[model samples]
Each structure stands twice: as C-alpha cells, then as structure tokens.
Target: MLTDPSPTRIDEATIRALPKAEVHVHLEGTFALADILFLAKENGEYLPGPAATLFDITTHDAFAAPAVSTGGGAGAGAAGLSGFLRFLDWQCGLVRTPAQAARVAYAFAARQSASGVRYSDVIVNPTHWNAWRGREIALMRALSAGFDEAEQDGLCAVGIAYSLLRSQSAASAVDAVATLASARPGHVVAISVDGDEKVTGRTGEKFHEAFRLARATGFRRTVHAGESSGPDGVWDALDLLFAERIDHGVRAVEDPALLARLAADGISLGVCPRSNLTLGIYRSWDEHPLPRLLAAGVEVTLNTDDPAPLGSCLEADWAVTAEQFGFDEATMIGFAARSIEASFADDDRKAALRSELAAVVDERSRTGALSS
Candidate 1:
C-alpha cells in the first residue's frame, strides 16, 4: 500500500537525504563570492565591495530590492534578473581559459553534491563567455573536463545544456546550435533558451529554425518561459521550440487550457520557487501557483534556477515546498521521481537512479523514519 500524498508530515532531514536531480541550474549563476574574488584577483579585475560583505548583501537582500547599477557595468545590491545577468556577464568574462572553466564546473558539482543532488543538467550560454569569443569548442572541452573530474570523485553526474540568449539575433542562435551540433561535447545533452523574457516577450518564433536544427541534430530542448512573461510565453515555447521541459513555468496555472495540455502531454515544469519570489514574480510562497498546478495534474519538479545567486539549494527548495504546500513524504518522493523522468539522462541511468530512490524510500519507511 502507498502512503497518502497529502498527509500532514514534515521531515526536513529526510528531504535533505533524498537523491534528486537538478535540471535547471545555470553555470554562470553558481559562482560563489570567494570564487568571484579569486577569479577577479587572478585576472586583475575589480569588484564593487569586499567579498564577504558583497556575499552577505546579495544573499540577504536578494528579494528586498532590485539590483542597482554600480557604475562599473556590473550590478550591485539585490538585483533582479536583468541586473544579475550583467553581473553574470562580468563573471563569465573572468574565465579566460579552459582551465578556469573546468574549475568552475568542478566547484559547481561539489556544491551540488553537498546538497544530495545526484545528477545535474547545467545550462551555460556561450555568449556570456566573452573571453572565449571564438573558442567555443575549447570552452566546452574545459567544462567537460571539470564535470568529468567531479564524476570521478562521485560528486555528481552532470550534463551541459547550451543556452541561447533571447537578445541575440537569429543568426547567432543558429550559429550556436551549429557549434553545439558540431562540437558535440561529451557532456552536452540539451539546448535551452534563456534571457529577459519581459524584454524579449517570449517570442519563440525568432529561433524556430535554430531549435528545429537542434532537434534534428539529436539534442533535447528546454526553454525558460513563464517566469517574467505569462502563459503565452509557455505556449510559444511548446508550439515553436518544441520544448521537452519548461523552466520557471509556474504561470501555466493561470490558463486552464494550458494546464490541461501540459497534464495531457506529461510535460514537466522545472519550477524555482525562491527564484520566482526573489525575482518579484510572486509576493510570497503562499501566493505561488505550484499547489494549483499540482492539483491540476501537471507534473512539477523543484529546482534552484540560480542557486548561488539566489542563496538557494535543491534541498532547501524541496524543504520549503513541503512546508509551504504541506507535502508528505510520498508527494515529495514523487517530485524526485518526476525529476529523474523529466531529465535527459539515458534510460539506464534513470533506471538506476529510480531504483536507488526506491531503496531509500523503502528503508526509511521500514525504519519509520519518514513518519517521524
């Protein structure tokens, strides 16, 4: 017999111990303040504030205010998505060599490992790495080297998702897809599009050709939509880009038809609740649409879109989701299973992960740990 999905239970420790998959994290957004300081010092760059002070400000005030311009092109204070992107651009500029890229990747995996993330699909936009302007292949190789090292250490298995910026021209998007298809980095598995959806308006038609080409080349697709835009953006992503998964697609709750379609098609939404809150997408966790989406039968998975920047982790995300939504152990475990199913990992890996999760759940159940 199965436990009730809606039972009133809170198990923070068990939630932390659950093996999960994070499919929406960004490589550009995972750099710690220490990492940033080290990179800046190594490259003779300057930052707005002391490393500790800056980290404290960004993490604590992330949702209090929009990121303010520091007059140095990078954002300061608790910046929103646009400001964060500028800071991310500046950070990416510091990584001038493949070795630097590898280090970043390795550190990101190490962090995820500490949070019990067994697998990760990390998104990286090549356009952000201005330092490696014409050396995209070298950059990919460097990132792959880092992830390979992390895997060897039993940290986590990672796959790269090459992301297209919505602000870029169609030609640039096509070029990126072509580069990804040609390079075919061992760790590269999917193509994604991310940017200021409010500025770009979630217009998927702009990159239809690029996404189509990516699909033809055997790459899976995901799109960032419904975070800043609306259900229309999510619709455009499905209709135009043929996205297999949607990132931050909570706005689908507003459209009954869209919810029905998603449930019928079994499409998964990689939701980042804290990201939505910090970005001003919702006033509070109580106001979030996740509960409604779940009730509507939509497959939902929790994630940290930009963990370091938002001061969030996969474990924390799940814990908060349970606390806020009153999710029981069974419901929480279902989210974990959904994450694995929605991932682009191979069937063998997915099967193994599922079995591992099942064993954990069984052990916890037999020991009565989940009910505690």
Candidate 2:
C-alpha cells in the first residue's frame, strides 16, 4: 500500500492533533482568499479579483488567477505561481503601518494554532512588504508584538526569520543583516535567503558576509535552496552561509556526495511536498524523493511552504506522506520530534515542545486512537 497512488488511509484527525512545529512557512503567502479579501478591503487596496469569484475560489485553485489579468506573468495554473507571488506582493503592499503588521502576525499564529502547530519559525522577507522596506526594525517589532499577543492567548509561539530576497544586492543583504544584528530583535530568530535560485543564480557568496555576521551575533541560519536549483545550491548554502537547515533540499538526492554530507552533518530539510507538487517540482507523489531521503537518514521535517494559496495544512502533510511512503507511527513522530529539535527556539522551549509531543503520543497510544 505504501507509495500507492491512492490516498492515505491514516486518520487525518490524529495527525491534526499531534503537537508539531512548522518551520518553512511564509507569512506573505499564508493568507487564504478570504483573508486576502478581508485584508484588501480593510486597507482599501483594489480587489485582486471579483468578490464573488474570489470568495468561491479554493486554495487549490487560487494559483490560477490569471497572471495577465492580475499582474501579467507566464500564464495561468503553474504559471500562476508567479501570479500568486504577485498576489502576495499586492497583499503585502497593503501593510502600511505597524498595527497592520501586528495584525498579520496574530492572524498567522491563530491559523497555525487551529492546525495544532505549537511553535513556528515563520519566514518574513521585508522585500515582500514593499511598504515597510525602509523601516525593517519597526516591522519586526510590530510582528513580534502581534505574535506576543497570540502566544498570550495560548496560540502557537511564533518567531520571525528575516528572509533576504536572493535577488537583492550583496550590499543590501549586508545592510539588512547589519540592521537586524544591531537591533537584535528577540522575536526574530534566524537569517535566511529565499527567492528563485534558478533565476538569481548562485547567491552563497552574495550572502556570506551577512550570514557570517548573523552567526556571530547568535542568529540562526537557514537557506532556501535545492528547490529551484540543483545540489550545487545546497552546497553553496552549506559552505558559504553555513546554513543549519536547507529549505526544499529535495534535489540533494541527485548527488550522492551531497546527500551523504547532508545526512552525516545532520542537516535538516524542511520539505514541503504540497508546495513542490503545486509548482510541478515532481510530476506526482510517486515521483517524490521524500521516502528516499528518509531512508538516506536525512532529518526531514514536513511543512506547508505556502499554506493558504497552496491549499496546504500540516496534518495532511503528515498523513499523506506517511501513507504515501508507508511510514509507521514512530516515523511520523520522529519527524515531529525533529521539527522541534531543529527549531530555532531556545533550549527550554525545545524541551517543553518535545515533552508536549511525547505527552500527546502517549495519550494517543493509550486511547487506541492512533492509526499505527
């Protein structure tokens, strides 16, 4: 039944209840169409599409909002990833004040809480928030203030990781890092470079100094690579930026050497299968290398890269990947445990989260609710 094209038989509710951490999600792209409509109307931005059509649009079909009609790109469907990206740019442009940024953070945490994600390290690239470009520190504070409120309400504990757009100039990268490093924002935990590596070409050298400065300042490092580029991009992130984790490093399987190094070094990959499938990274789930990577001992933790527009959720990721790969309950738990261990959260928080995961598993095991 493993690797069968048929949908997984695992209990999705069980997966939804598991204590988990989401590490690779992007705040800019996390908004639902409903959220998009709400945020747009609130800020008085032009409606992206007709209200009736947009409200009826599901996340799975959101990518098809005509690019030419929206902002003009490749076309529709997968071409609409660009369309969606433009959608994000438009939505993100609506945040003109710190209060708006805080609201975005609080809403993001609440959404994650509904999915049972106890903690999250969300990627927030200032470049996406064109309105807040010059005032990054204030932006960070506003987001943190929002997250702090959510946490107080017993929602997921959220940490911000500034994702440097890959296409930004090296000087721009350094300046961003310098500003963040100087402020040392408590809520912002890591520094990451995310964008189209295929389009931006190699950026390891471009971000080396910035990452070095970040590392020296005790900020964690993660990089978006191996998704758009090949194994070489992963290597550049590892060697150049000293990234502790590589987002979408699925392509590492292409190089035996790189794959071996990743495992031996215990580098984690925050793999987002739905994102990959939506973007046509693999033609089908059967073609995905997630199973192979797990077998190869990669510390792979599942995530929904762009949850809203991609129509993704963490529980579905766990259930589907478990059934598709024939993973046992222990394997699913291992992935969840690794997500906590791999987090940029402090040692005490990590321990608490790990305890929470263990407690949930034990309770489920006793109640006979677990699938396997």
Candidate 3:
C-alpha cells in the first residue's frame, strides 16, 4: 500500500539497497576525472579544466554543496552549456580505440553498482564522440562488448540508446535510423533524441519519419525534453516521436494538460534532480516540481544524468530527493519499481529485476533495515 501524502523519513542506505534501473544516463558523460586524467595523459589529449579542480566535482560533499560557478550560478540557466558540452567532447575523444571504449562501458557498470543500479538504458550520442565520426558502428560494438562482459560478470546490465542530436539535420536522422536498422545492433535497444532542445527549437516534425522507422525496426523510443526546453518539446516527443519514456520531464509540470496526459498514459519521467539543479532548471530541490508531479500521478523515477561529471550517483540522487522532498519509504520504493519498468531492457530481465526488487525491499522492511 502507498503511504500518506505527507512525506515520511527514509534512509539512504535503504534506498541504495533497493534494486533499480537507470533510464536516462548518458554514456558520453560517464567518465570519472581520474579516468579522464589517466586517459588524457595516455592519449595526449587536451583537458579543459585544471586538473586540481576537475576531480572536485566527483566528491559527494562537493556535490551537495553550492553549485560550481563556472560562469553559471545555480540560477544561470544554460549559461555555461558550451563549456559543459566541450568537456563531454574531450572525454569522448579519449577513447582512442575499441578497447578503451569497452573500458568506458565496463567502468560505467562498476560505478553504477555503487548506487545499486542493476541495469541501465544508457544514451550514447555520436555527436560528442568526434573520434568515431564514420565508425559509430564500431564504437557501438565496442560499448556493447564491454556491457556484455559486465553483464556476464554480474555487473549492471546496459542497453544502448542510439541517439539523434537535435542539432543534426532531419536527413541525417533518417539515415542514422536506416543505418542502425540495417546493422541490427543486438545491444542497441532504443532510438532517442538529445542535445540542447532550447538551441534546436522544435525539430520533432523533422524527425518524425526517423522515429517511425525506429518503431518499425523494433527500437524503443525515448527523448530528452522538458529540461532545457519547455513542455512543448515533451509534447512533440509524445505526439511526434511517440517516445515511451521522457528524460528530465520536470518542466511538464508547467502544463496541467500535459501532466494529465503523461499520468494517464503511464509514461515515466526519468527526473535527475542534481542535473536539473546543476543546469539551473530549478533553483533548488524545494523549487523543483517533482512533488507536484507526483501529486498529479506522474510516474517519476530518479536518475544521475551525468553522474561522474556532475558529482552525481543514483544513490545520492534518490536519497537527496527523498530527504529534501519528504518522500516516504513507499514512494521511494515506487521510484525503483517505476525505473525498472521504464527501462528498455528485455521482458525477462525486467521481470527478474522486478522480483529481485520486491524481495529486497520486502526483506529490508521485515529486517528493520528500512523503517516505515
């Protein structure tokens, strides 16, 4: 049964112990500063930030503190987006070979384990990886190889979401869909659209044919919207791309009608509180509309959008959201359940994960590990 509307206290340990899936994490943003530093030296690449402060963002204490003002305050919405994206490019450039790419994917699974993420639908936009300009299929295979190895070793399983940047041409989007469909990449489960929605304005109509082809080719659909853009982008995702899941749909709270449609359709929003705050979507957690979205019956799930770069982890995101927003234990459990359900993983895997989730959460309650 669900708890009262008034939020109850739930411990971070309990939230971490609960089984979950990450549906919105970007593969290009998964590198740790240590990894980046090591790779930079090995590959002789340029790193934008000073080595001294680059690693600071990975610390938990630093994450929960005031935002790192690299020309953007907490409220300076998208002020330093170019710098942030430049960092992603630099990180993606470090993968000089397929082995290195595999290492990135392998490390991602290991890192996610710390946050109790059992599986993930990770987005990989080729726009960031300039090194793989004409060899995206090879890069995808390398990542898939790494994820397969991790899954074989009982690490967090991953599904690749081949994303179309809103910055790209509609013809390119169609070509990408066709190429992916022809290749039939076994591990690439979904097709998605990402990048600065604000900068791209609205391109859903342009990519509608691509998304339609993606559906015909058996690719699940998800889209990045309602974070950098208004609720209209989300509406485009739903109405044009027919996205089944939305990444960072917090801005949908601005539209009552959209919120109602989302709830009625049972579409889940992969909300990353830390990313929103860091990106200045909302000034603070209290200012975020997560609670209001919940009240409106939206299926909300917590995720770390760019965990390593943003000093984020699923455990911390879940914990902070619960404590800051006064969510009860039951609500937190619902988060895990919803995340797994929203993932692009296979049905058998989802069912197994659901069972594991139930068993773990139930055991925690029984053993007093999770106090209600």
TM-score of each: 0.91, 0.91, 0.91
Cα lDDT computed for each candidate against the true fold: 0.81, 0.79, 0.81
Per-residue C-alpha lDDT of model 2 across residues 254-340, encoded as one tens digit per residue: 998998999999999989887776666777888889988988988998988877655567788777777777777777788889998
> Which portions of model 3 miss their true places by more than 4 Å?
1-9, 55-79
Question: Mind giving the per-residue lDDT tens digits that candidate 3 earns over 213-317?
Answer: 999988999998888778999999999998999988888999999999999999999888888887767677668888888899999888878777666677877
Worst 10 residues of 1 by lDDT: 68-77
Better of 1 and 2 by lDDT: 1
The alpha-carbon lDDT assigned to residue 358 of candidate 3 equals 89
Residue 11 of model 3, lDDT score:
57
Clashing pairs in 3: none
Candidate 2: where is the Cα deviation over 4 Å? 1-8, 52-76
- Residue pairs with clashing backbones, model 2: 67-72
